[model samples]
Target: MDQLEFAYPWAFILLPLPVLVYWFVPAYRSREDAIKVPFFTEILRALNETPKVAAGLLSPKHWQRGMLILSWMLIVSALAKPSILGEVQTREDFGRDVLMLVDLSGSMDEADFTTADGSTLTRLNAAKNVLKTFIAKRSGDRFGLILFGDAAFIQTPFTADQQVWLSLLEEAQTGMAGQSTHLGDAIGLGIKVFEQNPQPSEQQVMIVLTDGNDTGSFVEPVDAAKIAAARGIKIYTIAMGDPTHVGEQPMDMEVVQRVSQLTQARAFIAIDQAELDKAYQLIDKLEPQQYSSASFRPKITLHYYLIAIVLALHLLIFSWMTLRQMFSRAEVANE
Candidate 1:
């Protein structure tokens, strides 16, 4: 805990001053009292009466005076108004559960890609390189991998185990699943995987990366995207290939655009490796998770301070009472 300000802490110092004055100040009383004794003359002979024989110190009024002084000390302490100020903290976790749908058709084997560094590489190899980095950045997010060719298959289930997912990505090869693109089946499989865990509607996400038009699948790309939207899932489509490359059909832009519009998602065209990297970076920004935080202090103990104050007050009161009793006995003997 921390102190915001001292309202009137200095007033506490006056607590002891009142008690000191009470100890020194004498209580004066003016009253007439007549006591008839059988032998008044003999009593006067046995006892000595003195006006200033420490009678103030020996008076019963000292006890009553001490009580009044203690009351004032309590009042002063109450006026000091000591208080404590503190802080509170809170934290929240928000992340996306993404399913990566990759097209593993024969066209992906075409060697017509150039990295941003101007290095030549196959389309599949360049994609793997950039995808590894993207997977590494999603620390708290659960991810799954799907490879679609003539058929779609789950390479990895939804998990936060990025290392396992990256290893599976490295093993990906052209025509490993088959020689044709099944875009619709890949999305359908993605939906099934997401349904297994049933995450919050807003957190479910799907990203489709393909190098050619869909040629295999019982379902169509547009219909799959519509189903995804109805389930509150967002789909991002990426078309990967060069339009000018010989014997390489340009990516299916029309299908990609239609799917994106139906799902309320964005479509990206990566003609080369540099564009592929930028596409992933754009998705990273667009699907970012929201976060919130708050801070507070740990608990502190204050029992010792309270105990000390009580003990000190008790000692002071006990001392005053004992002194008053001694003074009363002395006054009676002198009379």
Candidate 2:
């Protein structure tokens, strides 16, 4: 039980006031009525023979009086509405470590993007749209971001603070991390970030988004994927852009698939904004790991309602008794 509102319980001191009133107040009694008869001896005999009706009706037994008093006290106490409070606890399940690896290489600048509304957009703009929504939906999960081109670096550390991560993402731009894709280095750096966090039994996640093949990196893509697999990291790859366009080379889907197979993850080819959106939506369906802490104040209260009902019942009883006494007196006066 918990108290939703009251701050001080000392207000209950007023409860005793009603008890004191009930204890001191005198009970109602009717005035004595006198009767005269011609045969004094016979009248006295008759009076002795008659049952003591007034004593039985007007003055109840001691136990009955006690019951009335007890009933009143109970009613008053109920009005006080005492409350008891306690704490409640709950646990959440969340287990996947997520790293968003974005390719900021020069090739990502290709204008092959179109919004869901049919408006033309840049690849960077389209990626941001999908990524922001994805981040927002992952509550209670630890996440990080990696941006790579000529070099790879951790843009944000693994954290549960989605707002801060999204803010850093908004500031991310092409060439800010350099203008050539280092796919292996990006994956390797993502692994390093995840390594810093505590490892759970479930697999960690690496989502790599790239438009071009690996052009700059000391590490090989296959070797990076092997390292990630050995560490139980699942890699989901997204290859962006239309391969059929002139001067646009098709991304190495076989290499991407090989990496996915090695790391026990999936690979996706997003030729346009719509495909990218669908790919991300699929990832969103996969739940993330969560951790949480809660604080509580407990209380219990039901006295007020009980008291109200009791008081109303007793008031009705008292009114009926008073009316009966008045009618009896009126009948005697008429006789």
Candidate 3:
């Protein structure tokens, strides 16, 4: 619960004004009206026989005066600006901005990776499952996703919302961008994203996952890594297939290792789902989200209720006075 406070406590000084007015000021004198009615003799008789009730300290009007005084006090209470303040809450300032660069080239569809239960899954699927868990566990850390095939695209911008990041990741389809891998362009894109949201060098990191080497990229992988290193961005490269496989598409572990080394980061080789999971776990341990936060308090006002009560009382008094006047006029017309 928050503590009660007032912004203008000095407004309480006027609370006793109504009471002082009632004590010192004289009551309004009721004038006796003189009117002659030739046809209505009962009018004269009624006027003469009516009791002369003086409105004084013990008059019935004292109740109205008391209500007026109370209404005034409430108005003063509203003016005093009563409020409640919430307790201070601290929020962490994320110290890390990790950009995940995923390869969406056609080769990612390879089902060489198998789960512990002996079920085979595409390389992308295995990576997605493990990365989902990894992203969710990183508290106080901002993450961004970049998908690349023949070209690179920012699937999701830097966000602290894990759900949004995962949603974007899950929506990605293999080779949606193109059939070839543009590894260097993806790294270059990551660097641009980091430059736009510049943070501390120690806090910036990029994780690149690809099964095949660069096929068609405008920038060279090594050159991109050099730029990233100069900008204080650490690059962790993961080669996700067997290096010995001979085909049109092949994993280049040496190039990946060189890129990682150039950026002062380590490289990992994951031939199966298990190794990929282990590599991510090691990365999580090494980075370990770090942050600093500041504390703050919130406030809520309570003077509105008092002001409403005062308005209600004023409306009641006005309505009563209007009815009394209407009845008095009827009596006069009848007489």
Candidate 4:
């Protein structure tokens, strides 16, 4: 509102057009200039002492012509399209791009974890429930899903639609990717996915939930974590399984901890459902909400005011002409 501007500033070229026309065009010429004076006496001069041409030049019509010119200027100014712009206000957006790397290996099918309802659920099911809540809390953030076992693959691409992401997460089944856990390959694949689009390091996050150590991977887990750190991608690793008893898939705490430390993140050992929930809660705290601001200024058109001024001047000219005509008719009737 403080500054005035034209949407189409080039239209200002028409502003001087009326002035140019008046300067370049010739004045009107009359076919006849005088009336015959047959008598050639002082009586004809006494009838009209003032010269008609000189009298016409001094008439009030000159004032009307000046008003017409002013009206034209207002019309041209309106056509130029003027507007007022307000101060820019910044809108802050708080969100982060999260890529979830989940283990869908055969061991995740273990129903050792129980829910708060005392009902039994598979490790994968418990993970799904916890993740559902976690993602729900991240309202404005974008999310992606990656499932890995013997081979790592992207289950869902990055998306902001929570419903769609949750649906995809629910669709996952154990051993869909493979029977063995390729923890390193999953991390590498996640890094590759993040690199494809690529955001600031602070804005990018990868959460890995696995029940076992790496069985076979083209890249080593620690090496992949180093790459993630160099690229500014934070990695939070959660080892979900009992570390005590030996099983088909044993949880590796050392590798997970190193991955987290290298990326300036925390490593969690989730033995049961409660521990896993707590781990996710800690991650939620560790990664604070990110805020980004964008500035924008609103604009309003002011051409209507100029148009109204032009209209008012023309109406005044018309009203004055009508009143003069009415007065002349009344004089003629009296005569």
Best by lDDT: 3
For residue 110, model 3's alpha carbon misses the true position, in angstroms, by 2.7
Residue 114, candidate 2: how far off, in angstroms? 1.0
- Per-candidate TM vs. native? 0.58, 0.58, 0.65, 0.67
Taking the tens digit of each residue's C-alpha lDDT, what string does model 3 give over 108-222? Answer: 8888998999999988998899999898788688899999988999998888899989999999889798888899999999999998875533589999988888887889899
- On lDDT, the stronger of 2 and 3 is 3
Error in Å for residue 144 of model 1:
0.8
Residue 58 of model 4, lDDT score: 33
TM-score of 4: 0.67
Predicted model with the maximum TM-score:
4
Worst 10 residues of 2 by lDDT: 49-58
All candidates: CA RMSD (Å): 10.6, 14.9, 7.4, 9.1
lDDT of 1 by residue, 1-335 (tens): 37533357797788778557768975665554355568776766678743232222354488667655666655565566544554555543537788898888888887888876777887788788888889887776778899989999999887778889889988899899898888899998888887787454358889988888778678998998889899878899888775444113555677789998888889998878879989999999998854334566534434344445656877887898899999999999999
Lowest lDDT sum, 10 consecutive residues, model 3, at: 50-59
Query: In model 3, which regions exceed 4 Å deviation?
Result: 1-14, 17-64, 85-95, 114-120, 139-142, 158-164, 192-202, 226-232, 244-255, 261-264, 291-297, 304-335
lDDT of 4 by residue, 189-234 (tens): 9988988864433488999998888887999999999999998889
lDDT of each: 0.77, 0.76, 0.85, 0.84
